[model samples]
Target: MIRSTRILGLAPRVAAARATALWPQLYHERVVDHYNNPRNVGSFDKNDPGVGTGLVGAPACGDVMKLQIKVDDQTGKIVDACFKTFGCGSAIASSSVATEWVKGKQMEEVLSIKNTEIAKHLSLPPVKLHCSMLAEDAIKAAVKDYEAKRAKLSPSKQRGSGGLINFIGDKAAIV
Candidate 1:
């Protein structure tokens, strides 16, 4: 009976210790911030020539992300970015951070963005790593869509298209 009472007393202490140790591993500050308040969560004008739309999904996790980018034709730089993500905390944070990083970056530079960067920034675990990959793929898809649209225009239209500058209000110019 004495041994049973001692074991019961240790249970509370052990549970408290476990909770304290697991708290940080289960949640990252940045991840929680982004998850609660996602950035650039919207859709741009899909039919606009300056807008490139990318829609991607992960079958295993049933996550879907739609990312859009508006480019400056003359400078070949991203002028604005937006995204709508339907997934877990990691997926939402990945897409949110991707949008923030893509704006003001050139198409080529945006393509070079790696999944590792997103994962590291959000402090994602192994299971959530795939969310970063999906974010990267979504950016590439949007860029490809832009390129494809640009290719279809006539030379005169192509030249004129470069003059359409996107106005992204409230977002600071990174460079």
Candidate 2:
């Protein structure tokens, strides 16, 4: 009986040690490191032909996300991306990941990218899942802005129709 009691106590101690060691991996890091800080956090003059800007938010969680891209209109390629995010660390991380993923990508390529991929890259917790969703929406919004510009330059063409379809293709599709 003494041996059994000693074993039981030792097991809990071992378990606690393991839990402590894994805590950082399991919990969301609350602070945004400089690298993870959302950069380009404000609007530029998107009226310029090559600029694309997107703004989005979730009222339920009180999270707001904005993303922008500068594209080479001739090549249909993204030349740069920037983001500003308001929320927890996870939101910041998601925006950071989204900006990295969108920059230098072809417009078509950015469309294929997924929120789950951003979440996976950041190792986001489930409770922060909405943050990833916001990132994805922001990307799509920026792309729509780019496509809209493309359409405006050649108003007689259907250049942005597919993108317009994509705009309303998801759960949070903004009209």
For lDDT, the strongest prediction is 1
Residue lDDT tens for model 1, 1-175:
4345334456767867876676457879888888878999999988888889999999999999999999998899999999999998899999999999999999989999999999999999899999999999999999988876775653323222444233346442222
User: What are the root-mean-square deviations of the candidates from the true structure over C-alphas?
Assistant: 10.1, 11.0
Worst 10 residues of 1 by lDDT: 156-165
> Candidate 2's error at 124, in angstroms?
0.7
lDDT on C-alpha atoms for all candidate structures: 0.86, 0.75
| lDDT, model 2, position 93 | 76
Best by TM-score: 1
Candidate 2 lDDT over residue span 136-160, tens digit each: 9999999888777866775444443
Per model, state how many residue pairs clash: 0, 0
Name the TM-score of candidate 1. Answer: 0.75
Which stretches of model 1 miss by more than 4 angstroms?
Answer: 1-25, 155-175
